[model samples]
Target: MTLNRRAFIGTGVAAAAALRAPMVWSQGRPRVVVVGGGAGGATVARYLAKDSQGQIDVTLVEPTRHYYTCFFSNLYIGGFRDIASIGHSYGKLAAEYGINVVHDWAVGVDRDAKTVTLAGGAVLPYDRLVLSPGIDFVDGSVPGWDVTVQNKMPHAYKAGSQSELLKAQIEAMPQGGRFAMVAPPNPYRCPPGPYERISMVAHLLTQVNPTAKILLVDPKDKYSKQALFEEGWAKHYPGMVERIGPDFGGDKVEVRADAMEVVIDGTVEKVDVCNVIPGQKAGRICEMAGITDGNWAPVTGYTMQSRIDGTIYVLGDATAQGDMPKSGYSANSQAKVAAMAIRGELLGSSVFPAKFSNTCWSLIAPEDGVKVGAAYEPTDEKIASVSSFVSQTGEDAALRKQTYEESLGWYAGITSDMFG
Candidate 1:
C-alpha cells in the first residue's frame, strides 16, 4: 500500500483541533515524550511530528545517535554489506520532522504526575507518553551469563557494539577454528534470526577457512522456517554447520569463558569464538513505570496502551502482544496503530479499528533471501491471525534473488518511513 503523506497530516490536524477548541487552545503545544528511538519509538515520533504540524511537541529520549538494525547485521559479518549501509541517523527526525532528540537515559517515571525523570535528575512532564525501549537480557536465564562476561561472549542481539565484537572475532579466528553459537529460547526478537546468522557466518567461514566448523546449540528442536533453513544450510554449507537440538543433546550445553571451554553433555570442548543470544525481557523503564508483569508490559491490543496506565502506551519487543512476534516490522505497524488511537482519545474523535501487518526477511546467502509475514486483526482481547505468508520452498533461483532484492527495498523503505 502506498503511504499517504497528505492524508496522514490531515488526520493529525483534525485530531489536534478536536482535542482543544481554538478559543481554548493554549500557547504551548501538547507534549509527547517518547522513550527509545528504535523501530517503534522512531516511527511514532516521526509520524506525530510530521502530522501534528507544531500542534504537538515530541521529545524523543534515546542514548544512541544512530540505530543499527539487527535484521541485516549478519551481512556485515559476511563482508557483503558495510555497517554504514545498515545504520541510520536521527538528524532527519530532529531537523526535518521537528522532533526534539534528547540523548539521555530515562531513569524513572511518575505515572500519577505524568512526569519522566532522566538520569541527570531532570523531570519532564508529558501529556502523552510512548515507550518502545526494546528488550533487555533476562538475568540468570542462562547460567554463568551476564554483562560482566559479555566481552568474552557477545550476544550481538542489539546490533551495535556486540555485532562489531562478533565480526572481529570471526575475522581473527585461524583456519579450522571452531565457531559456536548458543540460540535463545522461542518468542525472541526475529524468530528466524539465529538460524540466518548461522547461515551467514557459515558462508563466511567456507570461503575464508573451509576447514572451519560451526556448532549450533539450540534449546528447542523446532524453529521458525526450520525446514527451509535446514535445506539451505545443507545445500550451501554441507557439514560445515552442525545443529544440536534439545532432544539431540543440545539441552546440556554450558559455557565458561574465563576457562575458555564449553561443556556439552559429558564432553568439554574448546572454541575459537562464541556468540550467545540470550533470552530477553522488557526494558528497565517499563518496570520503573509499574507497567511490566514479569518480563513484559501488558497492553490493550486495540490501542497499544498499557493495561496498568491509561496515558502510557508500550510497543516493540518490550511489550507482550500475545501472538505477535517482537519484530521490527511488527513494532512499526503497532506504533502507527497506537499513534492513531492516541490521536482519537486526545481529540475526542471516534477511534479507528486497528489492523496490523508484518513482513520479516532473513538472508540465507548473499543473493538469496527467505521471508515470513502475517496480517493480524484484534480478536477478543489479543491479536488474532488474519493471514500469513512465506516464501515458496525449493523455488526457482530467480525467485530467491528477487526476494533478496525485495528485502533491500524493504529496508530502505522502512527506514525512510521511520526517520525521514
Candidate 2:
C-alpha cells in the first residue's frame, strides 16, 4: 500500500483516542479481527494478543484446522520434507497465545460497520481488521483449465491435497516419460515458486526416472534467480529439462483435460504428467471487500492499512506493496509493522519507526540453494528496496549448502513466529 510518503503512520495524538467508536464491543477491551490465518494473519493476531497481554481482544478467522504452508511444499514434493512437517495447527495460537481462533471462512467484510460476517453464522466486530487471504488464480490464464479440472492438471499452488495429487502423478510417470509444467506469469505469489517447484520435480525425476523429460512452458522471458536455477539444472539434471519462453510459444499454450493433451505453438503433445499454474491475483476475499484494485489490495505501507478504508489492513500475497515479493518472510515482516501500528492506535502503545526486510531462499538440488533478498523502506509511492543480495551463478558448494541450511532454519523460525 502506497501513502503520500512511505513512513510510519500513527493515528496521531488527537486521532488515537477518538479511533475507538462503534467498532469496539461492549465487553471492554479493543478487538482486532484477523482474516485468513496464513503467514500474515496468524503473525499479526499472535503478536497483537501476545504483546498486548490481556488488553487487546484478538480473533483469527480461518477455515482450516491445519494450515499447509506453500513455502516448504516444494521440499515435500522433492522428498526432502514430509507433509506433516509443513502442516501446522491453530491449537497453539488458541491455548498458548490466548487468541480466539475460529475455524470458519470470513464470508464478507462490512468496512463501514467494522464487522466480519462468517460463514458459520456469527458477526464479529473489530476495532481493526487484517486481511491476508493469499492468492487466487486468474480464470482463462490457461485455456481449458480451471478449478473444475484441477485434478487432471494439478496446480498444487495452495499446498494441500493438490500437492499430494501432483506428487502422486509424478510417481506414476513411466520411465523416460514426459512431464509438462504450465508456469504462471509475473507478480504471482512467490516470484520463485514455479521455478522452485520445477527444481523439485527435476530432483524427484532424477532419482525415480532419470531419463524422464521436463517441459517448462513459461510466459516470461526470464524469472527470479534464473541464472542459478538454469546452471543447477544443467549441472545436476543435464538435458532432462527444456524451457519454452514466450518468444518460443510459451504464452501460446493450452491444455485439454478430456484428451489428456497439451498444445504448445499449436503442436499437440500427450504428456504423462501436467502441472498447470495459471496467472494469479489476490484471494477472493479482497475483491469481495471492495478494497482491491482488480488484483491486489492497495494499502498504506506505513501501517499496512487499506488505502480505501484506513481501519482495515492487508498483508502478504493479497497486498500490492512495493519492492517486496509475495513471500512468507515479507508477509511476516509486514505483520509486525501493522501489529505495532494497530496497538499504537488502540492501546496507546509505543510506536517505533516502521522498517521492513525480506529474504527469499530457494533450493535447486540437494544441499544446493539460491536466494534473492532486500531491505526496504517506505517511499511516497510504495515500499522500495534499499540494499539487496543474491546468490551468484557459480557459487561454491559450501556456500550453497549454507544457503540451503539457512532456508531450513528460516522455515522453522517463521512458522514458529506465526503459530506461537
Candidate 3:
C-alpha cells in the first residue's frame, strides 16, 4: 500500500473499525490499551488498529491533545522553524484510524485485573496493556533540582512550554550573556538531543548575539557525536561554545535554582539562562504499578511484555532494553515489533523473533545535518549487534543537504507508519 500523509492521518477511524469489526463479527476482539501517545504508544496503536482488522481493540491513553516532538525541537530554538511545524494533532488517529485516543493521564495499572485507571477515575479494562509513558526525573541526582526548580531552569526535554521558556531566556539575554546547559547522564531519552540543542542554540546566538557564550556542563566524558559536534561548534561558533566533560571537572558542578547559579568546584558561575536536563528513570505510572524495580521496567525482549506482569508490555523509555538508549526512533521501532508479537499471541500463533532499526538526525545548522543509525537482530536472550552508520565528517554541502532532506523524510515515513 502506498501511504501518503493525508491518507495516513485520515485512516485512524478506518484502522479502528477494522480492529473492531472483526471482533464484533466473530468471537470477542482482544482489547489492547496503550498508555502514551508519544512515539512508542502512537506507533503501536496505529499499527494494531490498521493491521488487526477488528481482531484487536486499541485504545491509546495520553494526556496531550497535541504532541511536540523533541526530534526537531532544536530547529525551533534556532529560529529556523516554528513550534507549530513540529507539533502534531491526534485528530487523525481518532477520526481516520478508528483508534480511540483518550486525553487523560493514566494513574495506575491493576495488573491482576488487567485494568488501567485514569486520573479522572475512568477504568479501562484490557486483555493486553502497552506502557510507553516515557521517563521521569531521577531525584537527588542534582542538588536543589526538582519539579519546582524546573520552572526556573527549564530542561525543555519534554518540549512545549519549557522550550519556549528557554528560547525566551536566550532572546532576552545580553549580547555577551552566558547560556549554560547541564546535560543528563547516559541511558536517557534522545542521546543526541542535548548536543543538537546546543548546536542550534549556538547557531542562533551567532546571528543574534555574536559575543553570546554557551557553557555545556556534561557529566560524562563522551557523547553521541563527540568529534562531529566539536568540529561543528569550533568551525561555526568558534570560542562561543565551551564543552566541559567529566575529565575537566564537569561532573562536580552543583545547581542552585533559587539563586540561579551553578557552582563548579567551589567556583560560582552566574548565567543569564540555564537549561538543566536531569537524570531520568521510568515514568511515575510504571512505579505506581509496581512494575519497575528502579528507573525502568524489565521486559521480555521478544514480546516487550513486562517481566513482572506478563500481560503488560512496556516500550519506549519506560522499559529497560539493555544497551538501547531511550530514543523516539527506538521507541517507534520497538512498538512495531511488540505490536506484531501481541497480534500473534492474541491469534494463538507462535511468536517470531524480531528485528529493530533506528536512525536519529541532528541539525547543526539550518542546512547542515548529521545522523547516526543502526539495524539490529535478536540473539539468544537479547538483541545482538547488526550494523550501524554515522554521517562522515567534513564540509560536504551535498551530503549535508541530503541529511536534512532525509531527516524530514524520516519524520513523514514514521508518522505515516504510526498514524496511517
TM-score of each: 0.93, 0.94, 0.92
lDDT score for candidate 2 against the true structure: 0.87
lDDT of 1 by residue, 328-357 (tens): 888888888887776665544345678788
The TM-score, computed over Cα atoms with residue i paired to residue i, of candidate 1 is 0.93
Residue pairs with clashing backbones, model 2: 1-299, 6-379
| Per-residue accuracy of model 2 over 197-254 as CA lDDT, tens digit each | 9999999998999899999999998999999889999998999899999998998999
Q: What C-alpha lDDT do the candidate models reach, one value each?
A: 0.82, 0.87, 0.81
Regions of candidate 1 where Cα sits further than 4 Å from its true position: 1-27
At residue 246, candidate 2 shows an lDDT of 96
Answer with 2 or 3, whichever has the higher TM-score: 2
